[model samples]
Target: MTNLLDMRNLVAGYGYGPDIIHDFNLQIKKSEVKCIIGPNGAGKSTVLKAITGVLKPRSGAVEFEGKDIAGKEAYQIMRQGICFLPQERAIFPNMTVAENLKMGTYSLQDKRLAEERIHHAIETFPVLGERLHQLSGTLSGGQQQQLVYARAFAIQPKLMLIDEPSLGLAPALVEQTFQHIANIASSGIAVILVEQNAFRGLEAADYGVVMDLGKLVFEKPANEVLQDQRIRELYLGKAAKQ
Candidate 1:
């Protein structure tokens, strides 16, 4: 697989406070999922912020498809075939599902192509089709989350930066969300996922990375990381095995 993104020696922080992400490095290949896990304030989300242009990196390079995009604006990054969806509510509550989905195609220059992508996204997530005319906020939590992904899918991005996608969902919904996320990655787009459910996140990912205090502590195949006894004890609880 070819490397779609390469974030090397990333050192980022807020204002002049201090560097929260220190010499961090990450790479993702097409059609792969990389999950980042750690305790609260471990700077997992910070890494995504730096990559997505939400926070400028103090040093190092954020190379995507071979070009450096470290200091680019968020919109510029989006136009570069990278989509960042944060953990917070991403949908327009007052807009109908169809309207919100259509809004996703605003970046497309061709109306016909945008329409085609919207239709394709609806096919991928049928719930969006069912709730097309309904206000997005009227849908259930799981349904709203599905819509968020559906909108991203409409753009057909080369890489997606997703943060805490299953943050406040029920157990069953969380499982379903990860399933959809895995499906997206399998469909050929690389994904950088920041998830609170460490075990489930790693289970759904191709690569697993453990971050502590803004630095990577472990990097390995997802299954291998899951199998490590110390890692299992420290981050993923023993119950993760079952």
Candidate 2:
């Protein structure tokens, strides 16, 4: 239950733009699944960006394992034991799955070490074992999501920043993705998921956070948030209780 991610009074934004995320704070524990839910423009993705070093924090801190990586570049942060598999397609569509896995470890110094990590990743995803030579673009949306996940795991990251992982998938595929995410947490890597599907996201996460307009609104156990009528009505709307 050691804290893995710590953002205290975090304020971040694009260059010269207004702070889309300010006074943000959250903590994640080792091997835990934490989900963040909020309406659009709530800075959910921005939090991920800042944590993964895609955006710099104008003030405050983004610490992982007590190391501040606020101004580090994206690749530098990856070397710091954090990897971000963004909501967008993170793989090269034209590349084979094997190639994508290789691309993931571009920062590593040893090929054999990278391959060893990739072997472990295949253990968690047997379907990928058979599809090593397959082109990423040819895979289904769910499979593509899995491929991106495998690529992220190829380097053995300590924490994963997943943004809207279920975006643009079929219902069954979304379910599959969420299940995979749960499996990921069991593998002992802490995961922070930014998802728009609040209900499903909370169902897969151990902890839940509700953000509103760039501010922290509610912080509670996933089940508590799931069962709370007022919270569901406020953030999830009419379909929440269903």
Candidate 3:
């Protein structure tokens, strides 16, 4: 159970503003799904930003695969076997599904390997395969998110930082989306998930982390954390206990 990604004493913020994520520490093992849960402005997404190089850490280390990647740029981080899917649907509206998948492999130098990955993505997500020539913008919200997931997987990253995959989706779509993510984790790529839907996130996660006001407040197995009365009451509201 070696750590794939480790953030130690991380302090990061936007621009000249004060630090939003303070002394953040996290370690994710290979093939594990670690879900981060908290209310809005809890710096949950900020942690992902620091790891993915959207914002640089003012101090501390971001170690991926035993190498310190603290100050690397976003592309540099991606080259190191990590890819990020932001909260937003990042697909190109004008591009076809097949073309969007091709865009995801821009970093890979091997044409054959990239093509292999594309085929694998299509196989894993058959919807994308069936609609390869369809305009990505014309797809439903859930389909677009699925496309984003498929595109991220096209690079065959060892670790994926996914921000709010369920955002703006209906309940059934949210369930489908999490199942897709769970399937990805089951295939051995470590995932650090920032989720607004606490219940489902915990349900799908192997490990659960709770953050508040720029720091971690709780950490445990996802099931244990979900059943904790204190956590249930504090973050998930009173109905969680019933």
Candidate 4:
């Protein structure tokens, strides 16, 4: 089967700066979750930015559904069924939960379909439903994260580009965040996750990708990655090698 998303030979960086991603290549099947883990400055997040058009690739192709999407505007790429959740919390603090969800469907032209999706999101995350009228800023951090995920869910994107989903959460909330990612993947949406917590990220993913110095070090099935001695020693620490 054709891959859901294919990025080949991607080179990108901010304007006038040296490239941070070098000949990066990645591919994911529909509904598969690929987690990228590496030390700081490894360009993991740069790959997402290139694919999502936040930083246009200086070279190579980003293909989704067999069409090249390289250099398209972020909104254009999003409208074509890709949702990007940055490392920071994306919820609008001033908006009510219901209003936040409504914004998720902003790209959809069909009002009825948007409403249906909103209903589906609420059903999938009943907590969001219960908090619909509450101001998002007043919600707890975990609840606010839930609102972020719910909004992403409402969009029903074919692919989700998630950058550091567990970046700034209490340890207890971290597991809950990964569960949300798993839930999204289970619903048949491909996910490209860049996470700081390597072990947890790989556990939630079908595949584990390791990168360093702006290049891919290796890619492997998540289980194999978790078991590989070199990977364990390098990324997961000496304890993981036991």
- Listed per candidate, the RMSD to the true structure in angstroms reads 1.4, 1.6, 1.3, 1.3
Better of 1 and 2 by lDDT: 1
Question: Candidate 1 residues 77-181, lDDT tens each?
Answer: 998999888989799999999999998898889999999999999999997898899999999988888898899999789999899988888889888888878
Instruction: Quote the lDDT for 30 in model 2.
Output: 86
Ranked by lDDT, the better of candidates 1 and 4 is: 4
Query: With candidate 1 superimposed using the best TM-score fit, by how many Å does residue 55's alpha carbon deviate from the native?
Result: 1.3
Among residues 3 or more apart in sequence or in different chains, the pairs in candidate 3 whose N, CA or C atoms overlap within 3 Å are: none
Model 1 scores worst on lDDT over the 10 consecutive residues at 233-242
lDDT of each: 0.90, 0.86, 0.91, 0.92
Model 3 has an lDDT value of: 0.91
Candidate 2: where is the Cα deviation over 4 Å?
Answer: none
TM-score of each: 0.95, 0.93, 0.96, 0.96
Residue 107 of model 1 has an lDDT of 85
Q: Against the true structure, whose lDDT is highest? A: 4
Residue 151 alpha-carbon offset, candidate 1, angstroms: 0.4
